[model samples]
Target: MNQNSKISEDTIDLKELFFSLIAQWKIIALCVILSLICAMLYLRVTSDIYSVDAMVQLEESKGAASAALLGDLSKVTGGFGQKSPVDAEIEILRSRMVLGQVIHNLNLNLIVKDNSSGIMDKFLSQGRSRLTYQHDAVTFTNKQNSLIIKQLTIPEYYSDKPLILEFKDSNHFTFTYKDQVVFNGKLNQKNTSETNKGLWAVDINAQGELLKQSYTVSKLALPTAVKNFNAIYGVSEKGKMTGVIGLSYLGQDPEQITQILNNVLTVYHQQNIERKSLESKQTLVFLEKQLPELRKQLEDSEIKFNQFREKYKTVDVNAESELLLKQNIDLEKLKIELQQKQAELSAKYTNDHPLIRQIDAQISEINKKIADLNNRLTQLPETQRLYLQLYRDVKVNTELYTSLLNSYQQLKIANAGEIGNVRIIDTAVEPVHPIKPKKLIVLILSIFMGGFIGVLIALIRNLFQTGVKDSAQIENEFDLPVYATVPRSPIQETRMSILKKKKSIPILAVKHSDDIAIESLRSIRTAIHFALSSAKNNIIMISGPAPEVGKSFVSTNLATIFAQSNKRVLLIDADMRRGYMHKYFNLEVTPGLSELLSQQVSLEHVLHKTNVENLDVISRGKSPTNPSEMLSSTFFKELLETLSPLYDHIIIDTPPVLAVTDGIIISQYAGVNLMIARYAKSQMKELELSVNRFEQAGVKVNGFILNDIQRSSAGGGYNYAYAYTAQKDN
Candidate 1:
């Protein structure tokens, strides 16, 4: 909006930005300290987590033929083709069934902890429990037991509250808070009851039922146990197509995580073995059904052979027939086995598969042996050949039955000895150190987070602010030359503050002559002398854009400086509504401006001489209901014109220009209108608007006084003391 502000818009002012940040180092430091304290508390309260991991390799079976049992695993774990089997295995490893078994075997759902003290520590604790849960009394002392919640269940309503168990005897106890019983129950016995929250069922652990212990034990639901275990368990392949699955789970306890991962692997291994044996069991069932038919066929063949021998009265067979019968019996058994192999292979593989081709070749070899036996059989007599045929039928059935029985026995052994395809490459070990809450990383992030929050707070404050922080912006925007930049006077600050609090004002020119503010006032005196040399009168009016912009302060000090320079001056507090110029000198507030303007007092009675030589004061005599009308009256103009010849300069301190019409009405009578703008307190728009009001009233605003310019850090913007000292020393 202002030329100085517009100049900053085209290019970012790095110096201002840096100084603004420097100005708020305390905010940044506070944020960082608070953040660090929170971070330390977090690290102290949070339990450390340890990672226990196990590696397993799901080696693809070479020729398993167990497809009926172990199907493609990829569908379960997510993948296609070659990746499916391992993924499926991984899913099974993390499945509810496997996790439930692990939880049940290890008693993982029995949660116990000491919660008798502070709520925060007990609630957030994942560390080793203070009260150790035991199955027997020999492991710990039982005589000093105070409270024992053998079993407890929390419903939704009372989930956040603690159950205080007050032990009365070994077999009896009560749930109480502040020594009042909420519920009564006996040890070792299961009981279901209703409370204010919900229904609950509980029982003491069976092994430790007889022992009295001051501890709490809670059994988690089966589904919840499985879910918790599943959340902690993780499985993934080590590398693409590597088939090396890495299984892990991290928790507060080293032993717990180690046991958890080991249990998961053990369950998976057992399940795999059972799955692999399923196919063998199905095939065994089918083979058992054929055993009876084979036995009957053998029996019938034997009866026919015996009957044929009796009817033929001892028909003789040559050695060739015997050899042929033996050969046919062996060849038939081999052929039957090859056919069975072919049938089993057809279920999983194509006709051209290696296993089928191998079986077919074996069948061909057996067929050749049968053909050779047939050729030799033709050489025997017809009767012997008939006996050979019957004998051959009996032999074939007997050999086939014997071979099938042996094969069944061998398959039973194989099924019994089945093991999982997946092998444990590395078992989980108890970790020596935790994996979480990296201290260095947390501290670094906390510092950065603090800085980020500080910047956001600064930005938000700046966004809502309309105050001008720079003095140049006032001159550029108001089209007024800044006569002086008054540095905050530390020398007179304490004394002036005390005087103001006592309903008086300090005279800085007499109290501290070399003060920075007084030096700037002298500068203003010189600037005004040159600027108003051609003016019609020496009566100058001082006002501000807003109240409390040090307008009274500027009027008193400048008048004092001019009087000290041997020029007669009168400082008039023209703000009839609220002005205090008599506070600077020891004089009464009445018999001043209001009395003079209202014609209630004469000019000599209204004007009061101050302690400073050649300087006189006129205070705002009384508060009037219609200040605007009174300042606009002809009496005020006549009073000023009447005193014009006596004083070298008549300085009138008026109320804020934009606040009321007093400054605008009085500015028309003055030679030059001057306004004071406090640093970082007044806005550029207010300065521009206040100047515009004077120009509209046919009075040209001479310039601005940027008052109370605060000192800044060295190398920052507008550190006048540092610059002045540096120049003086040079």
Candidate 2:
């Protein structure tokens, strides 16, 4: 049972909140409309960004020509299979060396713009390129603006500072800096001038509207230009180890970004070629140094072999000696080649390195073979051995020289034919559409976002409302039974409209007998009838926590309901200040309660008859200085005692309990004391304080009437509905 009750409470709170939001639908609608307007404006002002991209692949192998040129030396260099990693190559593409060249080629450091001053011009220019034309130079011109800068140079300190170029005609123009004329020059001619500030140099071509509009030109520092360019530049491998890179750049102009990206690819390709050629060039230089020495050594060996033949004269060697000579020469040639390979490897690697150590071991083995061939040569006859030694020296030198010469020419050819291990698969092209400012998506999101904010605001307002909404809440919280929950009436609203227009109010219960509010009052009448049965006298005092809680409305209308039940009723406005109850019955304010209380008028003179049968009215008289004193006097008590017995029911409308002590004092005379709390306006704390004030004065409030409820204040099931038409139900 407890759990079910908790669930019921939760459901009611949610239902109440839902209705609260419904009550504030206008706020949410306004927010949504505002959001849509802002979204449209943003779409208008944001420039379209076109994206251009290029695709390139990195080859795992160095060029075939380079590998072939190295020949045997390819083993030492890691051969054709060696290539830089994809990640490293990607970084190199974005390096300053590569991108800086692109920037310089495109002349990106200079900026030019049309001097658009009007709101329309600036608005229309949002999605346009800064310059009308850009290639080797930048050009900008319109009906009211013209500027073309072929060359511009400014000192470092003046970089990024804007200068205005105003034309006097098609041929002449003046450059101004900070409103000061810096230089005057003719178009299509080189101009150079020095001022106190800095030297200025420029070459310009101008046309159309030269005198009507000026243009702004600013030079950016090279580093700053490169940094700005890098902001839009992007490059990455398509997949891990794929070696396929995708490059992209975003900008307003389709043609400019396309050209820029293609240029970047071109420059990167050229640099890669240069990088590959550098290795072959280094190897050529090393080989060339050995060529001259090897040539001279071969010459000396030939001369010595001929001289030895001349000195010995008719020298002959046995076949065994000849065999040993060929063996020795072959061994020596192999040994020399090993030593040369060792020397070249030593330049790049320490002797302790694995490759170097392996080469050293091979060279040692070749040297031992050479030594054994030398011993076989020593076994020959003395003259024959000497002749064989010269033959071996000449053969070894000739073979070594020829090998070095061939390798040198191969390297030169390879260097000339070298191409980098990178290939461009697709070049960037002009984009047909922009990639940004997705209109549908942005507008859709804005709608949701705006609605979300509106709902949040509604919920926040509901959370902050401290007023009593539910009549059951007052009953449960304050332990005071609410006799009736009176809904707002269109008839009452019409009466208020008439009263505002200075007309009289029609008593609601008589005019709208079947009205829901009247029905609610009938319920209150029943409760009052039961309470009056045990009362000291038949009188009810109606007051509220604060003004504007519909206490007077309840008091006047409730009396009309009792009068309709055939009971003689008297409605008295006891409030001496700011009471206008007489307006309801088309009566004047003076000569009523205040006049009667002060004994300035007799009872018959103060009392007035209303249009409703069996009802009498007494309006609060003209403003008084001492109303509290008069109401508490014996005369007021005797007046009520005198009038109470004559009426079946008497309702006294008093001032707000919190505003003054009049209601508390009046409560002492009435048998039934009731407080009227307006729905969604009378705060719980305020009502609690008002009740406390009455209890402290030793008067117990009989009950409360929750008044002027709107649909939102009455949460779903128990909420009352009314048919507001003059047509009778058949």
Candidate 3:
């Protein structure tokens, strides 16, 4: 049973916490509204960025095929058959050099944007251009196609700033800076330079329909252009060992990004081709020099063989000599070819190079072949061996020179028609969707953050609050009985305000008797009646701890409630310094308390009848030179005592006890004293000090009235009243 009760108490506490949060709904509402407004503005001011992608493949097969075309030349140089690492290739794709090429080719260095018409650019739709022009080339421009620039170069000072290139007539053009004309030139032939001394040769075109259209053009620095392009460029390998690469870029314009990506790929491919083409051209030059020398040596060797035969009368050698001669010729030819290859390899690569080492091995093998053929030639007669040796030298030279001749011709053709291995797997196309500024996510986060901020603000305000909360605290802390706890009724005050003109009297009781705040006054009337049952006089002095504690409010309403009960009540504004009862009753203040105390008016003239039934009032009257002295005067006490017998209940509204001795002096004349404490406005220390002041004055404050209770979680002491209302609703 104990455990169950504990759980139930916990649940109730949780319910109270929810009520507390619900009470601050206005704060949360304001936060959400502000956050939504900010989110909408962000959406309006931001622009969408689109992405375009292209695919490329660096063909490893093509690289090997080109190596095969080199044939013997491949063995000479070591550059062939080397495949670039995929990661390295990706870096190269994103390099500043590559990106700069893209920027230059697409004229990305030239920035062209519409001069936004105030804030309308964010809301306008971007569409396809009718025409585009570049490098004096016209494309699609006729009507709405307008003058889109292909290139624009400006001085460094005006890099990112706007420069107006306005069209005056069909062919006339004027470039302006800061609203001042900088240069005047004709269409299709304008200055486009980066220096101020020289004119800029801007490549822009316009057709008959767009002949009068003007545009803005700017030039970005090379470094800035590369950085911007690199920020947008993305390079990635498609799959493992796939040799497939994907390149993408992002921008606000689809047409521009697509062209830019395409141009980037073109530059990358061309760069690769150009790199490979260089090697072939070098090898062709080596081969070209060697080919003519080899041809001359071949012709010289043949002539020498013919001359030797003529000198020796061309002896018919033995069959064995001929067999030995053929073997020697084959060996010698291999040796000469190896030597020539070694020379070529040495010129292109270091001795440590793999291809150069391979050539050295081939030379060693040929030297071994020549040694074996030399031993075979020793078995023949001396004359026959001499003849065989000469014949072998001529035959070997002819074969060696002829083979090199064919290889040289092939290399020449390959160099002339150099083709790289790179292939365009896919070209960039226009993208349909934007890639940035996730709208839904931003809004969601804003909502959450706004709620968080509202809760934080509420907690902070609650922490620093200094006001008294409700009747419970007044009763427990001050040991005073709470006559009534009044909730704020702005509706009743609003109704009265609407009926009255500015500076007119505001009487809540005359117009809004059924208001909830008035109900609290009825309760106070009952409490006051019981408490003052044995009082010396019927006079009730309404005072408070501090100013703005609603002393006048409680007094006026409680007086009206008494009058409604068939008792004649006089509402007296005893606060001569700043009393406003005349405003409440719509009466003149000149003949009231101040006038009465100063002997300026008779009691009959000072007393005023209010619109409320059985209710009369005396205004605080005019300002006095010494309000405290007037309030403490014996005449003021006599005035209250005299009015005590005229009315069934006399309610005198006095100033704050802590602020002055006026309320304390006036309380001595009254039999019953009621202290008004404004809910959430009256401070605990201020009330304590006022209570101490009244005690020191030897005046007994009968009880307290806690008024103007607000409805909120922090106003927990007032929740019981609202809960009762809710139960009534059900």
Candidate 4:
């Protein structure tokens, strides 16, 4: 049972929290409106960023130069070739060597801006590369604020340091660095001068209000520019080992970024070609040096062989000797080719590397074959052997020189035609749209974020309320029964609204007898009847833990309910410190409760009958400084005693028990004391303390009246109303 009750309490608390949010709809709406405005402002002030992209593919060959020299050699050597890796190429694309040239070619390190443009103007310009604004008497063309800078060169010392160019007129300007005048020059011509710091050369043209606006120029250091470029630039391989690189750049200006990327690709391509050309040049130099030696050896060998032929008169008398001479020359040529291959391999790899080892083994094998062929030649006669030796030398030298000459011719042709291994698959173009600050998405998120904050604030406010919403909760917590649940009445609100306009306040019970609040008060009347049967007198004291809990409304309206039942009811506003019961009956405030308590007015004079047939009213006459003292006096108790016998029931409205001792003192004279707690307004702690105060003062609060309740769908709280509609007169 306890667990069930706990669950039920949690459910009611949740319902109360939900209704609290509904009650704070105005605050939530205000927050949402403010958030939307901020969102719009942000979308306005923040500039859009555009992206530009380009792609390049790496060829599979080891470049045109290497292919010319080693294409057939690779086939003979079981296919050994090297291609550049994509990762290395990507790094090269981002290298300072490549990017620096691009920067210099495009003048990317020279930063220029219109110093006259304010932040708002720059933001409103949508991040245009050029400022196009006009001042009085200044001319702005379609090209905008035309500040043309044809050439600008600065030394390393002033890199990234801003220099100001204040225009004297449309065609002339004065340049200054560090607030010191450096030079004065005219437009359309190069201006060169040397200052104490460094050299300066500048050429520019302008067509704006020269005296009104100025321009700033700063040359970034090469390394700084390259680093900045890397920050905005991105490159990667399109796929694994595909040798296809994709490059991209992001910036606020679409045209600038597009141009930057294209320049980068162009520079990278040119560098690749130069690299291949350099390799071919090195190879060509090596071949050129070897060609002279090979040619000399061939000539000398031909001379020796001719001399032997003359001396021995064609000593090759057998086919076996001729075959032996041809075999030795072929083996000797093969060994020379293998040795050349070994030299090239040794440059790239250690001697212990597999390729080098393989070349060495092939050379050793060729040497052994050559040695065998030479041995076979030695078996011939001396004349035939000498003739065969000179014949082998001529054939070997001739073969070696011819092969080297052929390779040299091919390499020269390849070098002239070398276009690198990288090819431009696509070039970057000006982007049509920006990639950032998506308006729709930003607006949507702003709305949701605003609502979230609003709900959070509402929940936080509810969490801090600590107020009682349900009468059952109060009853269970304090172990005190509630006499009646007075629902919020539209008629009472109308009365208050009218009073705020300085009109006479209408009595809810008499003017709107069938109102739901009156119906609840009739229930209170019934509860009071039973309580009075065992009380010391017929008087009832109504007060609350705090002010503005509608204790006066309950007191006034319940008295009217009693009067309507043919019982004489006397309603007294006993709170001498700020009471308004006189406004309800349209009576004078003087000669009432404060007067009667002070003995300034007699009982008969203070007793004034109201418009209601069986009800009389005693207003709180003139606020007094000693209200607590007056209420605790014997005269106040005697006044209640005097009025008790004259009416069937007497109800006294008192000040907040927690605010003053007036209520506690007044409760001592009443037959029953009741605390009025406004739903969702009066805190539980205050009510408990108020009741404890009464108990400590030797007065027991008979019960509580839960007042001004706003009925909700939550099932625990109570509110009285007409269950059926009233039938209208036909």
TM-score of each: 0.70, 0.78, 0.78, 0.80
Question: Which lDDT values do the candidates have, in the order given?
Answer: 0.71, 0.79, 0.70, 0.78
Please report, as a residue range, the 10-residue window in candidate 3 with the lowest summed lDDT. 721-730
Q: What is the lDDT of residue 472 in candidate 2?
A: 71
Clash number for candidate 1: 2
| Model 4 C-alpha lDDT per residue in residues 1-730, reported as the tens digit of each score | 2455567666645555566676666668787888888888888877788999999999966567667777666677875557888889988998999998887777777766667676577456653444221211112222343566777766667888888988776667887888987778888788898877778787776664444677787779988899988998999999888878999999877767887788888889999898767767877777888899999999999999998888767553588877777787777777766766665555557888998888888888888888888777788878877877887789889888998888889989999999888899999999999888888898888888888889989878766766776777777777788998777786566447457345256677888899877887787777888899999999999999988888777887788888888999899998788787777788888888888878887888888998988999998898877888888888777777777888898889988999999899888889989998987678888998999999999999999988766545345344233221111000
Q: Supply the TM-score for candidate 1.
A: 0.70
- Alpha-carbon lDDT of model 2: 0.79
Measured on C-alpha atoms, candidate 3 has an lDDT of: 0.70
Give every collision pair in model 4. none
Q: What alpha-carbon RMSD in Å does predicted model 1 have with respect to the real structure?
A: 8.3
lDDT per residue (tens digit) for residues 436-494 in model 2? 88889889988888888888998787677668777776776678889888777766664
**lDDT digits (tens) for residues 174-265 of candidate 1:** 66544566667776687678887778765543224223334444456777777777787788989998989998897876876776688788
Clashing residue pairs for model 3: 131-140, 131-141, 191-200, 191-201, 192-200, 192-201, 193-200
- Ordered by TM-score, highest first, the candidates read 4, 3, 2, 1
Report the number of the highest-lDDT candidate: 2
